[model samples]
Target chain A: MSSQPGTVRVPQEERTRAMRARLLEATVECLVERGFSGTSTTLVSERAGVSRGAQLHHFPTKNALVVAAVEHLTEVRGAELEKAAAALPTGRRRTRAVLQMLADHFTSPVFTAALELWVAARTDETLLAAVAPLEQRVGRQTHRLTVELLGADESRPGVRELVQATLDLVRGLGLANTITDDARRRRRILDQWAVALDDALADDDLQGETA
Target chain B: MSSQPGTVRVPQEERTRAMRARLLEATVECLVERGFSGTSTTLVSERAGVSRGAQLHHFPTKNALVVAAVEHLTEVRGAELEKAAAALPTGRRRTRAVLQMLADHFTSPVFTAALELWVAARTDETLLAAVAPLEQRVGRQTHRLTVELLGADESRPGVRELVQATLDLVRGLGLANTITDDARRRRRILDQWAVALDDALADDDLQGETA
Candidate 1:
């Protein structure tokens, strides 16, 4: 609700949340069809069937709208990871589940647009501030998953590095092949993950080697 | 040179090559500034100070100009790799050199533009064909370097996996980082590579029980 006493009769939390969700969804659609630079609040509002005034009420500026869209997509990504982690038995199953979840997310507009926006964010300071934490969060989940799946030897030479590397590989593949050959792209991703996981778990005392 | 003996004088082969090279450099400049959808053949010709007819003589279509640019970049990348490779002693030294060469190539506008073009290629079939083989060449080089550096143990357990994962990581970083913090990025990359390389060389054949 607005802090102003009588700004609106029903600036209720539910209404605001619903409007934000609609705008965010519309942003994803516009981003997918027209890219980050091409997407605009006008198009997003039109697609969401919200008046331009209504859209502005929720997001005062285009940058704000873009940031919110990125944040929303990041949350979707986090939720997907959580769902996958929840379904797994424990340990390596959880790791594999996360990988599968990543592959699935790449197929969705949320992941694709979020990534393109992340790339754009590198040039846009405001957007970068919003996306950096998302990356850190994903990195933390990956590192945690690696530790659980690989057990005590997770500290071994190649384990952590392997985690970072494999994560990047899937993300790169998703960016490189998002527009075509979905099945082939997914298989390539799974293959890369399966190999990286097996390698990390098998090595011991490797962490000290590089030092 | 034109084939007909009695025809009007055609441009010399060397002149044509020089003109083509100039246009390609300009195209790369345009690509770096405008991206795939924004770059234009006329802009490239103007940048090169060549007439449109001269530009068309070398590259008849917009796609052809891009394909030529990609080809020229690939050649430059290959030469850089060879030069870097030549500086190393043997074995792992050479592989490390290869890695440095890769880092260097990525910093070049030509290679960076090619990467941007690779993403664009996902939606453009002709561009995809032009870019696919370039990736294969890089992959093949990686495979060779891994074989030479790690020897017969590549298929054993996790070796191939670790190498692939590292490749993925570097590629992703190359695409995502904008401010070009090469020193820090390079250190992170080397740290991971060293870990993977050491583990691959380690003689342990069985899964360790614990840390």
Candidate 2:
């Protein structure tokens, strides 16, 4: 391929990017399939079909690989969330859409992978140090997007808490789902919370109606 | 001590109970600190200061030990929930108290220990089988208690879901707490949800208003 006319010039940078992406993807697969203690750099490289030396070059350590994978998943989820939020019409419908997204967000592969890291970190100082910052970064970023999605007025007495509660509530439901296949019950919970959320914002919604 | 008057009787059953209790307690400590892969029968026995023979005699396999520990924790937590519920005033204030208790319940040692099992079970088939049924049992029990505590009329259109949402929201908040120390935000979420729950039950709360 390097000798082909279109690819005559070297693609070292592209190759490096592709290699790194493969390693990260494999790392997530390993993390999701095997808990923290079970995942290793060697295992990930093997899974990605990358050599040990190449994996080492891309990520200096296993922590680096795991951390990068988590960050990558976070970015992907964040973009998905932003795209979904942007597509929604801003109003009660938008608010409901955002709440629905929150309920659905943490029950996926990313959260499952993240849960492995969080639990593994409880006993591992090195992994904890690597995971804590990334976890907080994703968390704070999610909170910001959620606040926007809810269009919740923070200055209002309980409004800010209402927005935050939606995130926490959905998170709890996801955690429960990890152990139980009760998506049906979870959807009902979401419906009920949707009502509560709508009610919490009733005054604002009313003023908007009056105006 | 066993040689003393009434104590001269060597109650094998009592000794067995004490040994089993020690093993279960150590299992939780190991789970919380070492995660699933890190936890082993050897480690648990060592931590419990019980002989390997004793540990094995009590819980023949690692799966048995881990599962029993989880079941033990669930039972203890269930009893605690019942006691807390029984202590609450049977009125609107009970509803608020119940929500607060639910928020506080999942943020404790039991939930942290359970988180380890849930993540560990994600990968291990044997562990998954052991954990899933126990998880479902506790979940159903918690739901039943939550309904009673909320004094929610499940017969009402969305009321049962409201009670379930209360549990899910608190569980999510607890999951967030594991990775980050955001107690302030959790409290705010709780306060906001309390208002929403109060509103959700505004009608039932009124019947007791005359009481």
Task: Name the best candidate (by lDDT).
Answer: 2
Distance (Å) between predicted and true CA of A120, model 1?
3.6
My TM-score estimates for the predictions, one after another, are 0.76, 0.89
Write model 1 residue lDDT over A1-211, tens digit each, in one string.
4587565655576677788899998898777776776788999999888889889988988878877786787677667666666566665555556666665665567767776665566546776777677666755765576455435354455556556655655665565555445455355445545544566456554544554
User: Which DockQ-derived CAPRI band holds candidate 1?
Assistant: acceptable
Question: Deviation in angstroms for A6 in model 1?
Answer: 12
**What residue runs in model 1 are displaced by over 4 Å at the alpha carbon?**
A1-12, A91-94, A102-108, A121-160, A179-204, A207-211, B1-11, B91-97, B123-163, B179-182, B201-211
Task: Please write out the lDDT profile of model 2 over residues A1-211, one tens digit for every residue.
Answer: 6468556444766888788888888898898888777899989999999999988987989888888998887888889988887787775566657777877788888888888888777788998898998888887898888877776667667776777778777777877777668688877777667766777776553211333
Task: Single out the weakest 10-residue window by summed lDDT for candidate 1 chain A.
Answer: A146-155
Q: For each candidate in the order shown, give its overall lDDT on alpha carbons.
A: 0.65, 0.79
lDDT of 1 at A80: 63
Pairs with backbone N, CA or C atoms under 3 Å apart (clashes), candidate 2: A169-B169, A171-B172, A172-B171, A172-B172
Model 2 chain A weakest lDDT span, ten residues long: A202-211
Q: Tell me how far the alpha carbon of residue A100 in candidate 2 is from the true structure, in angstroms, after superposition.
A: 2.5
lDDT of 2 by residue, B15-102 (tens): 8888898999899888877777788999999999999998888899988998899889879888888888878877656665777788
